[model samples]
Target: MSATQTRTGSCLCEANKFTVKGDPMLFVVCHCMNCKKQTGTAFMSNVMFKEENVDITGCQDVGQYADSNNKSGSTILRHFCNKCGSTMFGKPDETRKTGVVYIPSVLIDGSDAWTPTKEVFAEKKCSFVKELVINSPQ
Candidate 1:
């Protein structure tokens, strides 16, 4: 959890990998329909960080899709590993303009240690899901 520590992560096939420098800027759980469909799960845990802090290797194996069916009415560029079809990260054009990247927590190794600071689209949360109580340091 050191401020300057670098964290490494890879896709299911290990064909695509990345290293993120420093701590994450934000950690959020999203219950949006888009997230559920994209991840094929109830919700998605997104760990956000400045793009400058992330270094991705195996760019050639990474593919992207333009998601235009989001609730926020913005097209999100979703990146994934072509080899294993593992979704890696997303870049909302607006957020990308500001140099921010939202990586799926499941794709980041050791991300379970990070607590969710916020939850989005709670109205769409599943009935069996329990809300998380987080105490953010900031």
Candidate 2:
């Protein structure tokens, strides 16, 4: 773990808040159809941390929506703020070795470290968006 172990974030309406301890496992920009539709953007950037390292508060205002199963049969859980409808994160159904916690870049405070390590579903990326030169899962 890095010397800086804590990071903070809040929902657009300030109704949901959370703190994440430890450094992120990985960062990614997803260009899948589900992410594009959910975020209304070319892609969605997420920072992955360990679930145990995250402390969440004000979850009563959090809302969850899941997209249809993907080709890999993984269910994607989209978490957002019900009060202001700000999308906050995506949680995959698959259990990760580190117990992943995915947080959206827009809701993160320490965004300086949010540089994406890879892109996913690059084939689905918008034509208007320039191709990102990063490792991709295809």
Candidate 3:
């Protein structure tokens, strides 16, 4: 895809939609307990991008929670579709100043194209979940 390429996706109910531009900064698989609980899975995949590259429509249908129960110890603004309770993305407290946003890869259109560059909280990874091997973007 071109550097200016754009991707679009929406919540399960289509109550909230988003368009993101350019390639993602990082693609990560998180194994934190908070992530597992939030996604109802053993792990969660996230795609990171510069905050300015994303645009959301139907803001009124989105809900946010100040998540402070994670290992980070910082509050993360977790955005979800209020209508369907579909998790959308997370904006960490630092993101407000650094301008970075992480969205659930499952919520991205054509998500099959996503490749994980790294994994976080591996110590918390479930025993049955195999390790992910991916080429380093370095």
Candidate 4:
């Protein structure tokens, strides 16, 4: 994808909106227990991008929680909308890029433009979801 491509997204209530000015650096699906609990789903579709390349707005009621029990052991700030209780994004301190921000793939403006190459924390994935996927990528 070109670095110039732009993407925009918002929370369920549209109270927290944002724009990614450039292409994402990485995309993945996480089946970790914490991720599933946070999203209330079987897995989390996460997208990574340079923080400087993304823009945000309409966050008057946004809130965050410091998550420290993650795989990296480094503290991650989980940001979300306070009003709608939507999982918006996260900031990872020990990942490959410290300046990169983690966004939910559902927030991306389009579907065909983004694809998660791999899934993580498969060991913790639910049994019911295990029989669904094949030949995962990275």
Candidate 5:
């Protein structure tokens, strides 16, 4: 078996915990309407890891909801903590074959390492929010 790379994360209430391994294939900031509604913010920062490299413990206490759809016509799976209602992660159905896992920055201990390389749906970004040098998907 391949050795798993480990990165620790937790939910707002600390009720849910997880460890993600392997290099993230894509790191992005989503500014789509669905992302704004789900996060209640201008955008969502996400780091995609291979599902096989993720080991989630304490997830039994977590709540999952299927909300919205992606451009690929796939359902988005959102996982959060029931107690605190913290938005944890979003799973895009299109990347299921690659074991893709989207991890929210809030859960990460050292989130500075996961800076977004690009932004999606910038056309709908909040007017008050200024983006950095990250490229936006047209």
Candidate 6:
């Protein structure tokens, strides 16, 4: 595919570069405990796209962490760049056949057009998180 047809991005150290064609089919903010720890923040901004649309053209040090306690009851394969330790995306273990590449929004190159249209695992969200939105004047 032509470079202009895709969005290109890389890990913090630029050791791993990737490209995704087209916008995500789904965008979400996850507040599950695992998300907090995975992102080292209150929540994680995720952009889910069809797996075949994404291409990690360069990377030999991709690391993976299989999470067994996921709410979906399916093992979550969290993939990241081992060089800079940047958490990139995730996929449900082969058995689920979800075919979705759950990528961290910040890792996707381009503008800030992406926004979470949904939030999941709200019960696990920190109390302060609600205040930020509720207290907003919007």
The numbered model that scores best in TM-score is 3
lDDT of each: 0.85, 0.76, 0.85, 0.80, 0.74, 0.80
Clashes of each: 0, 0, 0, 1, 2, 0
Which segments of candidate 2 are over 4 A away from where they belong? Answer: 1-4, 94-98, 133-138
Alpha carbon lDDT at 4, candidate 2: 57
Q: Give the per-residue Cα lDDT of candidate 3 at 8.
A: 90
What is candidate 2's lDDT per residue for 1-138, written digit by digit as tens? 474578788888888888887667787888887777777888888788777777776466887886646665666777988889888866775542337878887686877655678888888888998966554334
Ranking by TM-score: 3, 1, 6, 4, 2, 5
* lDDT, candidate 6, at 44: 85
Worst 10 residues of 4 by lDDT: 129-138
Measured on C-alpha atoms, candidate 5 has an lDDT of 0.74
Candidate 1, residues 38-123: lDDT per residue as tens digits? 88989988889998888885456988899988887788999988888888888876644768888988777888788888899999
The runs of at least 3 residues in candidate 3 whose Cα sits more than 4 Å from the true structure, single-residue gaps closed, are 94-96
lDDT of 6: 0.80
RMSD of each: 1.8, 3.3, 1.6, 2.8, 3.9, 4.3
RMSD of 5: 3.9
Off by over 4 Å in 6: 1-4, 131-138
* Model 2 TM-score, 2 decimals: 0.85
Task: State the lDDT at 64 in candidate 3.
Answer: 84
Question: Which tens-of-lDDT digit does each residue in 1-138 have in candidate 3?
Answer: 666999998889887889888878999999999888888899989989998889875456887888998787888888888889889988877644568888998788877776899999999999999969754897
Better candidate by TM-score, 2 or 4: 4
TM-score of each model, in listed order: 0.91, 0.85, 0.93, 0.86, 0.83, 0.87
Q: Output the lDDT of residue 9, model 5.
A: 84
